[model samples]
Target: MASIARPALLRQVCNAAPTRRMASTFAGSSLKHPSPLTRRPMQSAFATPGASRVAAFHASGRRPILPPLPQVVDGDVNKPAPIPEPSASHGSYHWTFERLISAGLIPLTIAPFAAGSLNPLMDASLCALIIVHSHIGFQSNIIDYFPEKRIPLIRKGSFWLLRIGTVLLGISMYSFETNDVGITEAIKRIWHA
Candidate 1:
Protein backbone atom coordinates (compact mmCIF):
# COMPACT_ATOMS: atom_id res chain seq x y z
CA MET A 1 0.00 0.00 0.00
CA ALA A 2 2.80 2.47 0.83
CA SER A 3 4.60 1.65 -2.39
CA ILE A 4 1.37 2.09 -4.38
CA ALA A 5 0.81 5.52 -2.73
CA ARG A 6 4.34 6.63 -3.67
CA PRO A 7 3.57 6.49 -7.43
CA ALA A 8 0.33 8.37 -6.90
CA LEU A 9 2.09 11.08 -4.96
CA LEU A 10 4.81 11.30 -7.56
CA ARG A 11 2.20 11.57 -10.33
CA GLN A 12 0.46 14.38 -8.51
CA VAL A 13 3.74 16.20 -7.97
CA CYS A 14 4.56 15.84 -11.68
CA ASN A 15 1.20 17.29 -12.64
CA ALA A 16 1.70 20.29 -10.37
CA ALA A 17 1.98 23.63 -12.34
CA PRO A 18 5.08 24.90 -10.47
CA THR A 19 6.92 21.60 -10.89
CA ARG A 20 6.03 21.46 -14.62
CA ARG A 21 7.26 25.02 -15.18
CA MET A 22 10.47 24.34 -13.28
CA ALA A 23 11.23 21.11 -15.14
CA SER A 24 10.27 22.52 -18.54
CA THR A 25 12.28 25.71 -18.20
CA PHE A 26 15.26 24.36 -16.25
CA ALA A 27 15.60 20.60 -16.27
CA GLY A 28 14.85 19.97 -19.95
CA SER A 29 15.16 23.17 -21.96
CA SER A 30 18.61 23.75 -23.33
CA LEU A 31 17.63 27.18 -24.74
CA LYS A 32 16.89 29.80 -22.13
CA HIS A 33 18.32 32.89 -20.46
CA PRO A 34 21.00 32.01 -17.96
CA SER A 35 19.30 30.86 -14.82
CA PRO A 36 20.44 31.98 -11.35
CA LEU A 37 22.41 28.74 -10.91
CA THR A 38 24.13 29.16 -14.27
CA ARG A 39 24.81 32.80 -13.55
CA ARG A 40 26.23 31.96 -10.14
CA PRO A 41 28.77 29.70 -11.80
CA MET A 42 29.72 32.40 -14.35
CA GLN A 43 29.19 35.40 -12.11
CA SER A 44 32.81 36.37 -12.38
CA ALA A 45 32.36 37.00 -16.08
CA PHE A 46 29.96 39.84 -15.35
CA ALA A 47 31.37 40.81 -11.98
CA THR A 48 32.03 44.54 -11.54
CA PRO A 49 35.60 44.22 -10.30
CA GLY A 50 36.47 41.33 -12.59
CA ALA A 51 35.10 42.94 -15.76
CA SER A 52 36.80 46.23 -14.85
CA ARG A 53 40.02 44.45 -14.06
CA VAL A 54 40.05 42.74 -17.45
CA ALA A 55 39.11 46.05 -19.06
CA ALA A 56 41.96 47.84 -17.31
CA PHE A 57 44.38 45.19 -18.55
CA HIS A 58 43.06 45.63 -22.07
CA ALA A 59 43.36 49.41 -21.84
CA SER A 60 46.90 49.00 -20.58
CA GLY A 61 47.69 46.85 -23.65
CA ARG A 62 48.34 43.61 -21.81
CA ARG A 63 47.99 40.31 -23.65
CA PRO A 64 45.85 37.50 -22.33
CA ILE A 65 47.55 34.17 -21.58
CA LEU A 66 47.77 31.34 -24.11
CA PRO A 67 49.47 27.94 -23.90
CA PRO A 68 52.99 27.54 -25.18
CA LEU A 69 53.71 25.66 -28.42
CA PRO A 70 53.88 21.89 -28.20
CA GLN A 71 57.40 20.57 -27.78
CA VAL A 72 58.83 18.69 -30.75
CA VAL A 73 61.81 17.28 -28.83
CA ASP A 74 62.96 16.95 -25.24
CA GLY A 75 65.68 19.45 -24.22
CA ASP A 76 66.23 20.07 -27.93
CA VAL A 77 66.52 23.88 -27.37
CA ASN A 78 65.17 24.43 -30.88
CA LYS A 79 61.50 23.53 -30.74
CA PRO A 80 60.36 27.02 -29.76
CA ALA A 81 62.12 30.12 -30.93
CA PRO A 82 63.24 32.31 -28.10
CA ILE A 83 61.71 35.75 -28.04
CA PRO A 84 64.14 38.49 -29.07
CA GLU A 85 64.98 40.53 -26.03
CA PRO A 86 64.02 44.20 -26.37
CA SER A 87 67.02 46.25 -27.55
CA ALA A 88 67.07 48.49 -24.49
CA SER A 89 65.49 45.97 -22.11
CA HIS A 90 68.67 44.54 -20.52
CA GLY A 91 70.83 47.64 -21.04
CA SER A 92 72.43 49.53 -18.16
CA TYR A 93 70.30 52.67 -18.21
CA HIS A 94 67.25 53.04 -15.94
CA TRP A 95 64.76 53.73 -18.70
CA THR A 96 62.26 55.77 -16.68
CA PHE A 97 64.66 58.11 -14.85
CA GLU A 98 66.62 58.56 -18.02
CA ARG A 99 63.44 59.21 -19.95
CA LEU A 100 62.03 61.72 -17.45
CA ILE A 101 65.18 63.80 -17.13
CA SER A 102 65.79 63.67 -20.86
CA ALA A 103 62.23 64.57 -21.68
CA GLY A 104 62.47 67.64 -19.45
CA LEU A 105 66.10 68.47 -20.14
CA ILE A 106 65.78 68.39 -23.90
CA PRO A 107 63.03 70.98 -23.94
CA LEU A 108 64.28 73.10 -21.05
CA THR A 109 67.78 73.35 -22.45
CA ILE A 110 66.45 74.25 -25.87
CA ALA A 111 63.72 76.76 -24.90
CA PRO A 112 66.25 79.13 -23.30
CA PHE A 113 68.54 79.20 -26.31
CA ALA A 114 65.47 79.59 -28.46
CA ALA A 115 64.18 82.37 -26.26
CA GLY A 116 67.52 84.14 -26.54
CA SER A 117 67.30 83.99 -30.32
CA LEU A 118 63.70 84.31 -31.53
CA ASN A 119 64.64 85.29 -35.04
CA PRO A 120 63.67 83.54 -38.29
CA LEU A 121 66.82 81.47 -37.82
CA MET A 122 65.40 80.39 -34.47
CA ASP A 123 62.38 79.07 -36.41
CA ALA A 124 64.48 76.37 -38.10
CA SER A 125 66.31 75.68 -34.86
CA LEU A 126 63.00 75.29 -33.01
CA CYS A 127 61.66 72.88 -35.60
CA ALA A 128 64.82 70.79 -35.45
CA LEU A 129 64.74 70.81 -31.68
CA ILE A 130 61.13 69.61 -31.72
CA ILE A 131 62.02 66.68 -33.97
CA VAL A 132 65.14 65.56 -32.14
CA HIS A 133 63.62 65.98 -28.67
CA SER A 134 60.43 64.25 -29.74
CA HIS A 135 62.35 61.24 -31.03
CA ILE A 136 64.51 60.86 -27.92
CA GLY A 137 61.55 61.39 -25.58
CA PHE A 138 59.23 59.07 -27.47
CA GLN A 139 61.76 56.21 -27.55
CA SER A 140 62.47 56.55 -23.85
CA ASN A 141 58.87 57.18 -22.78
CA ILE A 142 57.55 54.00 -24.42
CA ILE A 143 59.52 51.90 -21.95
CA ASP A 144 57.13 53.08 -19.26
CA TYR A 145 54.64 50.65 -20.73
CA PHE A 146 56.73 47.67 -19.74
CA PRO A 147 55.40 45.61 -16.83
CA GLU A 148 58.70 45.06 -15.03
CA LYS A 149 57.59 47.52 -12.33
CA ARG A 150 59.80 50.59 -12.37
CA ILE A 151 59.21 53.51 -10.01
CA PRO A 152 56.01 55.49 -10.60
CA LEU A 153 57.60 58.96 -10.29
CA ILE A 154 59.97 58.12 -13.09
CA ARG A 155 57.31 57.04 -15.56
CA LYS A 156 54.41 59.31 -14.63
CA GLY A 157 56.54 62.46 -14.55
CA SER A 158 57.93 61.78 -18.00
CA PHE A 159 54.47 61.00 -19.26
CA TRP A 160 53.25 64.36 -18.04
CA LEU A 161 56.28 66.02 -19.62
CA LEU A 162 55.51 64.43 -22.97
CA ARG A 163 52.03 65.84 -22.66
CA ILE A 164 52.76 69.43 -21.55
CA GLY A 165 56.35 70.57 -22.09
CA THR A 166 56.23 71.05 -25.85
CA VAL A 167 53.11 73.18 -25.67
CA LEU A 168 54.48 75.29 -22.82
CA LEU A 169 57.65 76.03 -24.76
CA GLY A 170 55.63 77.09 -27.77
CA ILE A 171 53.50 79.45 -25.71
CA SER A 172 56.45 81.06 -23.99
CA MET A 173 58.33 81.57 -27.23
CA TYR A 174 55.29 83.08 -28.91
CA SER A 175 55.07 85.76 -26.22
CA PHE A 176 58.76 86.54 -26.46
CA GLU A 177 58.59 86.86 -30.23
CA THR A 178 55.45 88.99 -30.19
CA ASN A 179 56.95 91.38 -27.64
CA ASP A 180 59.92 91.82 -29.97
CA VAL A 181 57.62 93.39 -32.58
CA GLY A 182 56.75 96.38 -30.37
CA ILE A 183 54.03 99.02 -30.95
CA THR A 184 56.48 101.55 -32.52
CA GLU A 185 58.07 98.78 -34.64
CA ALA A 186 54.66 97.53 -35.67
CA ILE A 187 53.61 101.06 -36.73
CA LYS A 188 56.94 101.57 -38.50
CA ARG A 189 56.67 98.24 -40.31
CA ILE A 190 53.07 98.92 -41.36
CA TRP A 191 53.81 102.55 -42.43
CA HIS A 192 57.42 102.02 -43.55
CA ALA A 193 57.58 98.43 -44.96
Candidate 2:
Protein backbone atom coordinates (compact mmCIF):
# COMPACT_ATOMS: atom_id res chain seq x y z
CA MET A 1 0.00 0.00 0.00
CA ALA A 2 1.21 3.54 -0.83
CA SER A 3 1.66 5.86 2.21
CA ILE A 4 0.23 9.41 2.16
CA ALA A 5 2.50 12.40 3.05
CA ARG A 6 2.02 13.95 6.57
CA PRO A 7 0.75 17.33 5.25
CA ALA A 8 -1.69 15.65 2.82
CA LEU A 9 -2.97 13.33 5.57
CA LEU A 10 -3.51 16.29 7.96
CA ARG A 11 -5.27 18.32 5.20
CA GLN A 12 -7.55 15.36 4.42
CA VAL A 13 -8.54 15.00 8.13
CA CYS A 14 -9.09 18.78 8.60
CA ASN A 15 -11.19 19.17 5.44
CA ALA A 16 -13.49 16.18 6.17
CA ALA A 17 -16.99 16.96 7.58
CA PRO A 18 -18.78 14.89 10.28
CA THR A 19 -20.28 11.70 8.84
CA ARG A 20 -24.10 10.95 8.73
CA ARG A 21 -23.69 8.36 11.51
CA MET A 22 -22.23 10.99 13.87
CA ALA A 23 -25.13 13.48 13.24
CA SER A 24 -27.77 10.74 13.56
CA THR A 25 -26.46 9.69 17.03
CA PHE A 26 -27.54 13.05 18.53
CA ALA A 27 -30.72 13.51 16.37
CA GLY A 28 -33.23 12.53 19.16
CA SER A 29 -31.32 14.06 22.06
CA SER A 30 -32.05 17.37 23.93
CA LEU A 31 -28.40 18.27 23.25
CA LYS A 32 -29.44 19.57 19.76
CA HIS A 33 -31.13 22.55 21.55
CA PRO A 34 -29.83 23.16 25.12
CA SER A 35 -32.18 24.54 27.88
CA PRO A 36 -32.18 28.23 29.01
CA LEU A 37 -30.61 27.16 32.34
CA THR A 38 -27.57 25.82 30.39
CA ARG A 39 -27.41 29.07 28.30
CA ARG A 40 -27.33 31.42 31.38
CA PRO A 41 -23.92 32.48 32.87
CA MET A 42 -23.03 30.78 36.19
CA GLN A 43 -23.56 32.94 39.31
CA SER A 44 -21.47 32.73 42.51
CA ALA A 45 -22.88 33.19 46.08
CA PHE A 46 -20.12 35.76 46.84
CA ALA A 47 -20.85 37.86 43.70
CA THR A 48 -23.17 40.98 43.84
CA PRO A 49 -27.00 40.33 43.45
CA GLY A 50 -26.24 36.62 44.07
CA ALA A 51 -25.81 37.52 47.80
CA SER A 52 -29.65 37.35 48.12
CA ARG A 53 -29.47 33.69 47.10
CA VAL A 54 -26.94 33.13 49.94
CA ALA A 55 -29.34 34.92 52.35
CA ALA A 56 -32.25 32.77 51.08
CA PHE A 57 -30.11 29.64 51.74
CA HIS A 58 -29.43 30.80 55.33
CA ALA A 59 -33.14 31.68 55.81
CA SER A 60 -34.07 28.14 54.76
CA GLY A 61 -31.45 26.84 57.32
CA ARG A 62 -29.99 24.30 54.93
CA ARG A 63 -26.31 25.04 55.76
CA PRO A 64 -24.62 27.24 58.32
CA ILE A 65 -21.89 29.82 57.47
CA LEU A 66 -18.36 28.40 57.61
CA PRO A 67 -15.80 29.73 60.12
CA PRO A 68 -12.78 31.74 58.88
CA LEU A 69 -9.41 29.98 58.39
CA PRO A 70 -6.78 30.17 61.14
CA GLN A 71 -4.14 32.89 60.63
CA VAL A 72 -0.50 31.72 60.26
CA VAL A 73 2.31 33.98 61.47
CA ASP A 74 5.29 34.39 59.13
CA GLY A 75 8.80 33.92 60.54
CA ASP A 76 11.98 35.76 59.50
CA VAL A 77 12.41 35.80 55.71
CA ASN A 78 16.23 35.33 55.70
CA LYS A 79 16.47 32.60 58.35
CA PRO A 80 16.33 28.91 57.30
CA ALA A 81 13.64 26.50 58.57
CA PRO A 82 14.41 24.32 61.63
CA ILE A 83 15.92 20.91 60.85
CA PRO A 84 14.05 17.76 61.97
CA GLU A 85 15.78 15.34 64.37
CA PRO A 86 17.07 12.19 62.63
CA SER A 87 16.19 8.59 63.60
CA ALA A 88 18.28 5.46 62.89
CA SER A 89 15.26 3.39 61.76
CA HIS A 90 14.16 5.73 58.94
CA GLY A 91 15.16 8.73 56.73
CA SER A 92 18.83 8.93 55.57
CA TYR A 93 19.98 6.05 57.83
CA HIS A 94 17.51 3.62 56.18
CA TRP A 95 18.66 4.75 52.70
CA THR A 96 22.34 4.41 53.66
CA PHE A 97 21.70 0.90 55.08
CA GLU A 98 19.99 -0.17 51.80
CA ARG A 99 22.94 1.17 49.80
CA LEU A 100 25.37 -0.68 52.10
CA ILE A 101 23.48 -3.98 51.56
CA SER A 102 23.52 -3.45 47.75
CA ALA A 103 27.29 -2.67 47.79
CA GLY A 104 27.98 -5.68 50.08
CA LEU A 105 26.06 -8.05 47.72
CA ILE A 106 28.45 -7.34 44.78
CA PRO A 107 31.53 -8.64 46.71
CA LEU A 108 29.56 -11.50 48.35
CA THR A 109 28.31 -12.63 44.90
CA ILE A 110 31.82 -12.70 43.31
CA ALA A 111 33.79 -14.09 46.33
CA PRO A 112 32.24 -17.64 46.29
CA PHE A 113 33.07 -18.28 42.54
CA ALA A 114 36.50 -16.60 42.73
CA ALA A 115 37.52 -18.65 45.83
CA GLY A 116 36.41 -21.93 44.02
CA SER A 117 34.32 -22.97 47.05
CA LEU A 118 30.91 -22.05 48.48
CA ASN A 119 31.09 -20.90 52.11
CA PRO A 120 27.71 -21.70 53.74
CA LEU A 121 27.77 -18.42 55.76
CA MET A 122 28.49 -16.31 52.62
CA ASP A 123 25.70 -18.10 50.68
CA ALA A 124 23.21 -17.54 53.53
CA SER A 125 24.21 -13.86 53.88
CA LEU A 126 23.82 -13.32 50.09
CA CYS A 127 20.38 -14.92 50.07
CA ALA A 128 19.24 -12.86 53.11
CA LEU A 129 20.51 -9.61 51.50
CA ILE A 130 18.74 -10.43 48.18
CA ILE A 131 15.44 -11.06 50.00
CA VAL A 132 15.78 -7.79 51.95
CA HIS A 133 16.65 -5.90 48.75
CA SER A 134 13.59 -7.34 46.94
CA HIS A 135 11.33 -6.48 49.93
CA ILE A 136 12.65 -2.89 49.91
CA GLY A 137 12.03 -2.60 46.12
CA PHE A 138 8.47 -3.97 46.47
CA GLN A 139 7.84 -1.69 49.49
CA SER A 140 8.97 1.30 47.40
CA ASN A 141 6.59 0.23 44.59
CA ILE A 142 3.67 -0.15 47.08
CA ILE A 143 4.42 3.27 48.59
CA ASP A 144 4.50 4.90 45.13
CA TYR A 145 1.38 3.23 43.70
CA PHE A 146 -0.88 2.58 46.74
CA PRO A 147 -0.21 5.48 49.09
CA GLU A 148 -1.91 5.51 52.53
CA LYS A 149 -3.54 8.86 51.75
CA ARG A 150 -5.10 7.60 48.47
CA ILE A 151 -5.88 3.91 49.11
CA PRO A 152 -5.35 3.22 52.81
CA LEU A 153 -6.93 -0.28 52.82
CA ILE A 154 -5.05 -1.42 49.70
CA ARG A 155 -1.75 0.05 50.98
CA LYS A 156 -2.13 -1.75 54.36
CA GLY A 157 -3.11 -5.01 52.59
CA SER A 158 -0.13 -4.82 50.22
CA PHE A 159 2.26 -4.11 53.13
CA TRP A 160 0.91 -7.08 55.09
CA LEU A 161 1.08 -9.28 51.96
CA LEU A 162 4.71 -8.24 51.38
CA ARG A 163 5.62 -9.03 55.00
CA ILE A 164 3.90 -12.46 54.82
CA GLY A 165 5.58 -13.29 51.47
CA THR A 166 9.02 -12.24 52.75
CA VAL A 167 8.61 -14.39 55.87
CA LEU A 168 7.51 -17.38 53.72
CA LEU A 169 10.48 -16.83 51.37
CA GLY A 170 12.94 -16.72 54.27
CA ILE A 171 11.43 -19.91 55.76
CA SER A 172 11.67 -21.69 52.36
CA MET A 173 15.28 -20.50 51.86
CA TYR A 174 16.22 -21.84 55.29
CA SER A 175 14.51 -25.17 54.50
CA PHE A 176 16.33 -25.32 51.11
CA GLU A 177 19.70 -24.61 52.74
CA THR A 178 19.19 -27.22 55.56
CA ASN A 179 17.36 -30.05 53.71
CA ASP A 180 19.16 -29.91 50.32
CA VAL A 181 22.00 -28.12 48.44
CA GLY A 182 22.36 -24.44 49.33
CA ILE A 183 21.79 -21.62 46.77
CA THR A 184 25.48 -21.39 45.72
CA GLU A 185 25.87 -25.17 45.32
CA ALA A 186 22.60 -25.36 43.35
CA ILE A 187 23.84 -22.58 41.02
CA LYS A 188 27.23 -24.33 40.54
CA ARG A 189 25.47 -27.62 39.76
CA ILE A 190 23.13 -25.92 37.28
CA TRP A 191 26.08 -24.12 35.62
CA HIS A 192 28.05 -27.43 35.22
CA ALA A 193 24.89 -29.23 33.93
| Candidate with maximal TM-score | 2
What root-mean-square deviation over C-alphas does model 1 reach? 14.8
In model 1, what are the clashing residue pairs, if there are any?
none
Candidate whose lDDT is highest? 2
What are the lDDT scores of the predictions, listed in order?
Answer: 0.48, 0.68
lDDT of model 1 at residue 128?
Answer: 43
Model 1, runs deviating above 4 Å? 1-124, 127-148, 181-193
Ten-residue stretch with the least lDDT total in model 2 = 12-21
Model 2 per-residue lDDT tens digits across residues 126-188: 889999999999999998988554568999999999999999999999998788788988988
Give the worst 10-residue stretch by lDDT in candidate 1.
Answer: 34-43
TM values, all candidates: 0.25, 0.58
TM-score for candidate 2, residues paired by index: 0.58
RMSD of each: 14.8, 17.1
